[model samples]
Target: MSTESPSITGPLHDLTVIDLTQMLAGPYCTMTLADLGADVIKVEPPAGDLTRHMGPHREGDSPEALGGYFQSVNRNKRSVVLDLKTAAGRTALLRLAATADVLVENFSVGVMDRLGLSYETLSAVNPALVYGCVRGFGDPRTGGSPYADWPAFDITAQAMGGLVAITGPGPGRPLKTGPGIGDIFPAALCAVGILAAVHEARRSGRGQFVEVAMYDAVLSLCERIVYQHSYTGAVPQPQGNTHPLLCPFGLFPTKDGLLALAAPSDRHWREFCALIGRPELGHDERYATNTGRVAHADAVRDVVTRWLSSRTTADALAVLGGRVPCGPVNDAAAIFADPHVRERGMLSEVEQPGSPAPVVIAGQPIKLSRTPSAVRHRAPLLDEHRDEILSASSAAGDPRHNTSQGQVQ
Candidate 1:
């Protein structure tokens, strides 16, 4: 790598993450750790991560060098490209894995074993190395899945994990969430698994393999569906903007747009009644408590919906400001102009590899007092750190440089 690469300053600065992942889930997980100051060494194939070519690029920018999608999930990382089909590449990777604190991959089951880079093999090379994997079902080590060998992606997980089943306008027409929560949620869980395993490794002087199945992770996210099914013994149909058990807990149309309100508890319901100029409703026997309101949901909806129709989003927020939990159902333009997003530094400008103009992207969400993390640098160029990573060549064998490249099977 060059001296221009970002410097380590976060809590994870001492750790090295050997990243063998692509697309969304695995890359996003490693990116989160990289944001926390881990030295993430992205090992790509001879071509590169597929995402490097998948994007809306600047008119003159090279597809091999920049992609909007790749740039979003790959900041603050160093890249190395290697041909794992070659003996030299496998040897180089094993050497790098020997020194790494963690090794993360999202290859299909048995891919690691076929390539001789499984946790069993790597742990023998370095017993303290944390091995993490994100798969459609799960790694065979944890429990062999019936679909262990099936190639899966975000939509497959969302469907099988029960997220798609409950999400949509109604039953028999389930819709995937607008965002790729199927992949993103699994990636987030895998990151959490990596950190938990890392903590245990630090204390026990050993490490183990951890796997996050996309199906399982998304299933966990849709917890209410499972619980409601178990308790009621009936399939829950989509209720649209209204929540099943909580009244005054969904999207309500305003004069101009939409806003969300969640005043299901008795106290909030009382305060909500007062805020909407209906204080008498707080003492009404039919809507006195959450359970009562839920039973009389039609009445509750009529009251709130009518009140919302008479006011605009801003007026509603002004009236309900501190007394109720509510917010505008913001569109992109509104979100961009939002004061809260600005105050929280939610948007960050990052300089990419080939473009003269910097691009704006979402900022790192995690905050640390002593070791803050951020979008410290641009997405890497393919094999940009090859010389620094591979030994027997110039710039290699430096103790400060702790990364290598290899194409995962």
Candidate 2:
């Protein structure tokens, strides 16, 4: 199958990452690295990542029957099966480790140690190998966590990490976010950790263990809540769609659907009042300043509600689009149709494995002028590159991986 864009040789082309992680958090981290042109060799178990079976899938998908969820995070990388439990498997992995600039995993605490592949063990073999992981609480290397052995998923982390408490419409109405930010935030942080470790390794010829606890990442995401509690001794409740300190900076119902408007600043609030034909309110004593408006939040919301109810989302945006930051609450179809999204190249069509038809996924959010990262190849098949990778002599057979010739996409 042909690609949508020319093969991108990215800025991280010289790096190699051994991906022992599976599922969302771990794979998501490596996927970011893979997208940037690192040689991410996904070392899966014989049964494969559980997400390999995750749907929704197309009819004629590969024997592996790779599903949409699997394809999203595993693209732009090669795959190889290895039973880490087996002696030969462990032997093969350590050999591969010798060539890896980084090795990442997200298994529960002590899985690597149980498998005799801990950072202490691997670092002995490859002194410059950056060992990174994402865990529920955290690893003991950086800081030991009391809940180190606790098993946590996205929801658990969201709840334990304080996000769920402050999310949703009101107190006692805690809500988990639609996406798995609990896992994703930790993954993003781990990526930064890997890069930092790699940078230091380049300078010192030494590597260190880097990790992110899902709970810690979620807490970091809710930094504002932390300070509010500390500064005022007030446990912030869910303020629905509104900002805690900024009145008129939240969701408002429009004629057709939900739309968001933010007039937190005095200039924006005055402009908003003028735009809604209520210029007098800009100077009204009741709504004079942000503090006064927030002191009478219901009155503020009522005015906004009345104004927005008079217009459709499109009509509202047409007038306010550039005047202030605003947009409609978009569905998938609407997002796909939006000109701004297309102009920014947010959606990308790619040759997906199993599906005869190409599927569209998100493009890189971080764009570089020279490197211009992209989705180069489809997600790999099970053990797709085993022969080419396991045998250094046979690496030439895989033209994509002949690094000596500067081709490593």
Candidate 3:
């Protein structure tokens, strides 16, 4: 299969996104832009994206695999390598910024300032530039802590922002989210901010600074816990995969597999009881109402589990369909094989240079009717576009843009 670009062209087709981010969070944001038809030029330092050499390698490809982790989000973007540690490189980057519609970065706070590429400095050269930044914490100007200079990643954010407190099975078993959701999700949110800022810039001809912090984003994810703690002075405990206040809202094992069920309302509870052929459950004084059911969740789960033990996931799902909210617990393979997922085009194929078979990647979520975004290219080699970008940019005038260094490709 060709790793040729997908046919979809999105509204941001003409937009230029200069990606100065590294690792997962920043790269993930720029990848979304690339998927959305933006011309995202990934500006890597001489060493290239660190993730390229961070993981499981293919034979011969060795240290440059860029890791499967890197490929997932770095696809469809052009890369240029420059030694930003030098003055000439800084000059080149600024020139690129002058031509770019937006620039994204995820370095610790003040790195940009130290490099003389802060929003104030850059906007002087390019008044309409949309500068999006992802930080460990928030900017000090945004009511964040002065320790914004510190480095952080997903797990640290989850722990500091209160997600860890309200996660997991119960007390003392506090768990972090299985994925680097804290980083990835904030990157997504920051992408939105960048896009929105660019849209506004187009109209007003004024650029603005857009920022998202891993901690701040995770805090948004912890809204309920924050509210509960503030209003009721109640310390939220880990409830694992289940909701603390909703019974029958967690994982339940079926004969063949696990299924997730949610019957939060009194009406759903009645519907659930009827579906299970346990109408007595609806009449039982201890489980008749949502509040009662929550208070007696252990007994409630026991009653629900007994019925699930006898049924296959499909049978249970079919009976509960539309009436009561439910779904089977699908693993990754199951997710890829699911008919609905395939129908929705949630999986896409990407051709790697040396791999025998094309790698399948998750599809972009933002679907547009007029200008739809689609996968256009495989993830480029480190500084793969160094020659192309430098040549084109150099011919455009400044020699600063043409001097490529440390680009591996």
Output the number of the TM-score-best candidate: 2
Model 1 scores worst on lDDT over the 10 consecutive residues at 400-409
lDDT of each structure?
A: 0.83, 0.84, 0.82
As a TM-score, model 2 comes out at 0.93
Query: How many residue pairs clash in each candidate at the backbone level?
Result: 0, 1, 4
lDDT of 1 by residue, 1-409 (tens): 1122255488888888999999999999999999889989999999899998787777775444477799889888888886777877777777787777899999999887888777887787677889999999998789888998899899999999888888887778788888889899999999999999898888877888989999899989999989998999978776678888999899999999898999899999999998778999988999998999999999998999999998999999999987799988888788888887766767777775555667766777888877887777878889987777665322334222443222111
For model 2, the run of ten residues with the poorest summed lDDT = 400-409
- Candidate 3 residue pairs that clash: 5-376, 10-371, 52-66, 168-240
| Candidate 1: residue pairs that collide | none
Candidate 3 lDDT, tens digit per residue, 1-409?
A: 2234667676778888889999899999999999989988999998888887675555565343456777788888998988888998887787787777888999888888888778887777677888898899888656668667788988998998888988888888898888898899899999999988887887778878999999899999889988888889999898776787688798888898888999988889988898878988887899988899889988999988899878999898889878898888888988977898776666777766666556767778788877877777688888788887877655556523333221112
Q: What is the C-alpha RMSD of each candidate to the true structure, in Å?
A: 4.4, 4.2, 4.5
Pick the winner on TM-score between candidates 1 and 3. 1
Candidate 1: Cα lDDT at 341: 76
If the candidates were sorted by their TM-score against the true structure, best first, what order would they fall in?
2, 1, 3
Off by over 4 Å in 1: 1-8, 60-65, 391-409
Score every model by TM-score.
Answer: 0.92, 0.93, 0.91
> Highest lDDT: which candidate?
2
Off by over 4 Å in 2: 1-6, 60-64, 393-409
